[model samples]
Target: MAFLIRKDFPLRGFATCGDCGSNLRSSWSKGKTKYYPYYLCQSKGCDSYGKSIPRDKIEGAFADVVKTLEPSPNTWCGLKPCSDVHGMRDWLKPKILRV
Candidate 1:
């Protein structure tokens, strides 16, 4: 299949090439009947240079990994029930964050 290209890339700066350590560039590739989003390594000599990873695959994995992260316990000052905007304000107003 041949691809038609566009320049915008949501993961442009944050994602990198796994084989060459160059950044992964992204674009919308036109498929036989549709447009597909792909992330690819564009470094000149890399073994994985032209291979394309579907955008949903990479971004979905990224989101999954992000879901596993948590703020450090020491950095959490407090949590109060968010019943309303005023309640939220009340919760935040008195606490001096721990870290």
Candidate 2:
């Protein structure tokens, strides 16, 4: 029997490598009493390819990207509620609820 370990990080599939254009992967390093998260690019032959990026740094940068994405009212008006999910299950819920 074989088992696989999977690490699910927030930016796992969302971020791409700046050098080789590969998707970034994330993992945790075990410390004396705790675990630390890090993101890395797995592409071969790229500089800084396998180097780990500290979780706080990567996550902070992602947060900054999110901060700059406030949609204008016109942009909001073009979106419709998702038909696949029930009430309050769409991405626009928070903005809708505020009004």
Candidate 3:
């Protein structure tokens, strides 16, 4: 009752409530014979306040939302240079222009 078996909060800062706009809080809860993870809104007076949503439900929805998100070509271009091998190549290549 005072401690949790699972204490990780993967969505704490990223997931917010639709009604309250407050960041969702996660916690481990006692359920019959097992401890279950949950996401909830702790903002007072909000419609979702104190309502415990299962971790799987929220994370599944989060995964689905991001499933269709593809980085643009520009993103790859920008990140390519940030990668170690590419960065070294760019840095080591000749910068002088031949006349």
Candidate 4:
């Protein structure tokens, strides 16, 4: 099958292969009746180098990880104001003064 670059793959550069520690690349395959999305490791010497993982499975696993990361409200509140350098400097000023 001819391979084409797809921009819709959300995890293209973000996901990594468990076995090879290489970034996972995604592509679409034309089946008999439909197109299927898959993520694969392209590393030359890795055990799972050419193995394809179904898109749903990879995305679902990412979703599961995101679900488990429930940051507390206090942490969010603390970080919300430090979104920029000036804000971070201001936030750190008080702590530095105390130290």
Q: Estimate each model's TM-score.
A: 0.63, 0.66, 0.68, 0.68
lDDT of 3 by residue, 1-99 (tens): 122223376555556787887767788999899999988899999998999888888878777766766879886676544457444434423331110
Give the better candidate number (1 or 4) by lDDT. Answer: 4
What does the lDDT read for residue 11 in candidate 2? 50
Candidate 1, 1-99: lDDT as tens digits: 122223454445556666776667787899899999888888888898889988887777667766776768864566544556455544433332210
| Candidate 4 regions with alpha-carbon error over 4 angstroms | 1-7, 78-99
Q: After superposing candidate 1, which stretches have Cα over 4 Å from the reference?
A: 1-8, 73-99
Task: Write the candidate numbers in order of decreasing lDDT.
Answer: 4, 3, 1, 2
* Decoy 4 TM-score against native: 0.68
In model 4, the clashing pairs are none
The runs of at least 3 residues in candidate 2 whose Cα sits more than 4 Å from the true structure, single-residue gaps closed, are 1-8, 82-99
lDDT of 4: 0.68
Q: Looking at candidate 4, what is the lDDT of residue 30?
A: 94
Cα misplacement distance, residue 14 of candidate 3 (Å): 0.7
Give the Å error, residue 52, model 4: 0.6
lDDT of 4 by residue, 1-99 (tens): 222334567655556788867777788889999999998999999998889899888878777766776678786776854447455544533332110
In order, the Cα lDDT scores of the candidates are: 0.64, 0.63, 0.66, 0.68
- RMSD for each of the candidates: 12.5, 8.9, 14.2, 11.4
